[model samples]
Target: MKIPERYQPKNNKSFASYWQPTKDNLLPFLLPKTNISDSEKLVPYYFKVDDLADEVAVEYFTNTPFNQAIAKLHTDFSLFPSNKNRLSLATQNLFQQLNEVPSWVDFDLVNLGTSYCNRTGTAALSVLRNYCLMGGYESSAINKPLIFTQALHKGAVKRLADTVDFWMYVTEINGLKPNNKGIYAVLTTRLIHAYSRIQIEKKSEWKSELWGRPINLWDMLATNLGFSIAFIDGLSKLKFKPTAKELEAVLHLWKYVGYLMGIPLHLLPNTGEEAAKQLFLWSKSQKGIDTDSKQLAWALYDEPLRVTFTKNKIMKWFVQKTNLGYNEVLLGTESRQELALPYSKAKYWILFLNKINEYFDTKAKSNPDYYNKIAKQGRKAQEKVWKLYQQAK
Candidate 1:
């Protein structure tokens, strides 16, 4: 698909030349017309057709007997034996949609990306936990249903499981392939989001202007960008810089993942730089923060800490302190003020620790044993987070 003229980068400049790492670039994009109605609405210009396609898929899954079996499996995996026929039928019906792996995907690049994620370790977790969570809350489209249902607080374990499954897919071998655990998890999430959209749209209180359809294409793109572009930016702020090649591999990994998750090809950028620009454009198009944004942001910020650290005050304090610093730096002043996060001396300490870790990481990259050790540490941390999710449940 040809890129839209408006969406194309200005002057046809390469993203590296077009993007500047400065305060101006970090600031949110401003829409040209401030007073226009629906300024806050994130209409999927590039992917409207794809959105329609997804809607059809959702309708089929929701109305079919296959969905019943899927739900049963969710409740008890042991029931899979009884539902084998239904599961087979459902898998066959969804095969073409779920089986596709983009022709452009490079397994080597995916492995490179996975390695980079492993190397970054806890720094990546900080970004996923704080920065991405903050972005989700900032979006009125995402925040409303979450806030209205109190899902972040009440369904914390299920929510965390979904997140863990996502990371495992991106980081695991052959994760994006059809019938793999990662791909299956991704498909299930797509169905769940589609189901949520259908259920939420039926409510009288669900405002189309603010909420859009649940999991609209635009919102999905924004969420994907958070994990890719915004995530890398967050890591950079923490002084953990990936090589340009490593960064590109990370983008490549997520681009394919986005494709599997039903985001259109036109909307998925080939490079991290373009992804950043896309995020900025999407952010500028949205309306200012609302009550729902604030409520949801605060709840997400507090709930995970409360749930995970309940037994150890010292551990909770340390995580909270580091998290606060990371969120402040990544979210920037505007988001911090909007979310009402307080300024802290801990930010200075956080940066210092990041620089110290970066030095060690740089040295460790040359030593295979050290590299393997950190990778194991990173995996262990992920397992701990998964355990926390289970405990929270």
Candidate 2:
């Protein structure tokens, strides 16, 4: 990686300034079941990783206690390598890039994305786990790092907890600003990914030519798309309609988050059309599911059963099946089969529940009190979900 145009900011204006989900521009948010017609391609991004982090991680991990330091850095971003080290000037450069705000950032839009997350509450969580994260497993090439890191053995609850925490932090209003928890989360995650890439590349089993880097730029951008477009699409399935402006703001929010996380922002998508095309090509890179795929997917598939949110045996069963149904509905039949997730009658029942909620949501959204009440309900449910996972044995 030659570090192409490092700190290359996205050139698009704010969501409200230029783009709207008009008929000509309103490409459906759904991930298409067939191949998309697009000139852009995904193969090249596979050759890229976070060059700045890659350099810092290599020097730091090679010099320090690898596992212990990686663990400590989760709570302390200051442990990241600095300018004093003689090997390279990556840290001084990295901080400079982080501090320089891109011309495109709009804090109001960022906060809108956060508001959307909080308003939908547990539905956002469900959509993320079932649609975005679980759906990610079908592309077997991406799971190498998780397997290498013993993610399945450590359990899905642990993995999901970390993921959930990161989402919660970054979506908070003004969370991505310097010295904030959101910034801290991105810093910790970026280095952790870099650490994994280093460790995985050293293994005899990893074929760099076939899979690209362990967590290449392609995969990293795809993860960002998962949070941005895929997340919005998943919420749509639940009949939660965000305005055109709101939709674009969600993508805009993740664009900045991706920036802070050291993803090569030049390749990050700012609109629905761009995101759809990028994701379609990236998904094309998958070969098929294997044992490791099933092992990893199973971790999340059974996670609801382990959550200690409710002592009522019947309610727990309902929650478990609803989770399975959610996977079935959002992931489509093919992905459910690929993941080997069990069938549940609750899939249709779940759809019916959404229809009823949508009716109320449509009416309530016009009134501030009603919408705030819905958001409160959503926040409460999200808290329960997070607490149960935290308390899970």
> How much is the lDDT of residue 38 in candidate 1?
35
Candidate 1 clashing pairs, residues 3+ apart or interchain: none
Per-residue alpha-carbon lDDT of candidate 1 for residues 1-393, written as tens digits (9 for 90 to 100): 332222322332212211335532331221122332332233544324244434544545565676674565343323334444655444443445556555788988886777777777667777787777765565554556675555755654456556866786667756766567776677667766665666666778866544455566776887788777777776666666667777798888888878877787788888755676577666554554567677666665565456643688777667667777777667665677677666666778777777786785686566778876776777677667666665665
Best by lDDT: 2
Q: State model 1's lDDT.
A: 0.62
Q: Per-residue lDDT of 1-393 in model 2, one digit per residue for the tens?
A: 322221111331111101223322222533344352231255556667888888877766776896676654443345433423533567657655555678889988888777777788788999888877887887677777898888988888888888887887897768887667888778778888998888888889877665667888878988998898878877777877777777878989999988888787777877777776666555543555667888888888877666655668777788778888888777666668767878888898778878875875585478878776776677677877777666663
The residue-level lDDT of candidate 2 at 318 comes to: 82
Best by TM-score: 2
Could you tell me how far off, in angstroms, the CA of residue 7 lies in candidate 2 after the best superposition?
28
Clashes of 2: 0
